[model samples]
Target: MLQLFKKYSVVIRFIAVFLGSYFLLSVLYNAYLIYSENQTEFYPDFFTNIVSRQSAAIMEFLGYSIKLEPHETESAVKVFVEGTFLVRVVEGCNSISVIILFVSFILSFFAKKRATFFYILAGIVFIYTINLIRIALLTIGIYEYPQYSAVMHDIVFPLIIYGTVIILWIFWVRVYSNLEKNESQV
Candidate 1:
């Protein structure tokens, strides 16, 4: 086992360090929030506040009629508009954000050694923005095309969120790795 890792030391080191850092950071932040809540009811309020505010800002910028307001339910933020669908923002969903963080870190590790942490941080923000857009579109889509709920929620919307992450990963690979440029030179 040691011999195998020695042969792939660089690759293993990149994966271990990047993933380890991402997981620890994400888990710590989320745990802090969860533990800070005074009661179980506070979880949804906290989670939805972040998601709804982010989503609403994007929707407002797009000039949409829909608006998000936080409605305190049993322990969650029920996001709704006067004439639109409702969505409950919760903690587990934001795990997607964590996954994105991990992926960005891993990609950055494979990027140029001189790559700045700020660049990787920007990638994380880009991913989060993409996710916000996805949620906003999903809310509108749910209202506009009620019959497409299964496909939209299960397939299409997830593709948008996860696909954006994939695109970022590829972008990092190309820009940092310079694969195309290297191939051309070869």
Candidate 2:
């Protein structure tokens, strides 16, 4: 037992610390967001406000007669515009964001100490901004292109977001990992 522990102690310790910390932080943050959103009914209100604002702007620009109203559907009260289009906003777990967070954590684990936190922070900001823009664009796309709406919302948008996350992960591995290599050589 002692010999086995000694052989893999460092690996075990690193895994324990990293995985344990990540799980704790993720769970706590998710719980807080869920609690806060539930308390304030923030999802519906926020979705309504954003879609309405953007939809109104788009309609005004295009000279469309669509007036969006918050209508209660079977499950969610969606913003129904012109009695034809409906926009629903729901905020929940963003798996891609969580994946990005974990990837950033793992990449920065092997990076320079001083640069690691900054790299991870930048990744967080990037992921958050992209996610919001994705949602907004998806809403707009659904409203405008009713025919291609299914493809855009279901297939294309998901690919874009997930692909962005994968690309960012690769960038960190290729470029940032090279930085660590260069530093070691110096």
RMSD each, Å = 4.3, 4.8
Pick the TM-score winner.
1
The local lDDT score (0 to 100) that residue 45 gets in candidate 1 is 39
Task: List the global CA lDDT of all models.
Answer: 0.65, 0.59
Q: How do the residues 1-186 of candidate 1 rate in per-residue lDDT, one tens digit apiece? A: 999989999788877877777777778776866664765444453554676677877766777655554455544455565455466656545544555464546544554444545556766677677777777787777766778877988899778767876776666766766754775799
Per model, how many backbone clashes are there?
A: 2, 0
Q: Poorest 10 consecutive residues of model 1 by lDDT?
A: 39-48
Q: Candidate 2's residue-wise lDDT over 7-126, tens digit each?
A: 988677757767776777778666765554444343434533454455455555655444544445422335445566556644332333455455535543556766666766777767
- Which 10 successive residues of model 2 have the least lDDT summed? 89-98
lDDT of 2 at 166: 73
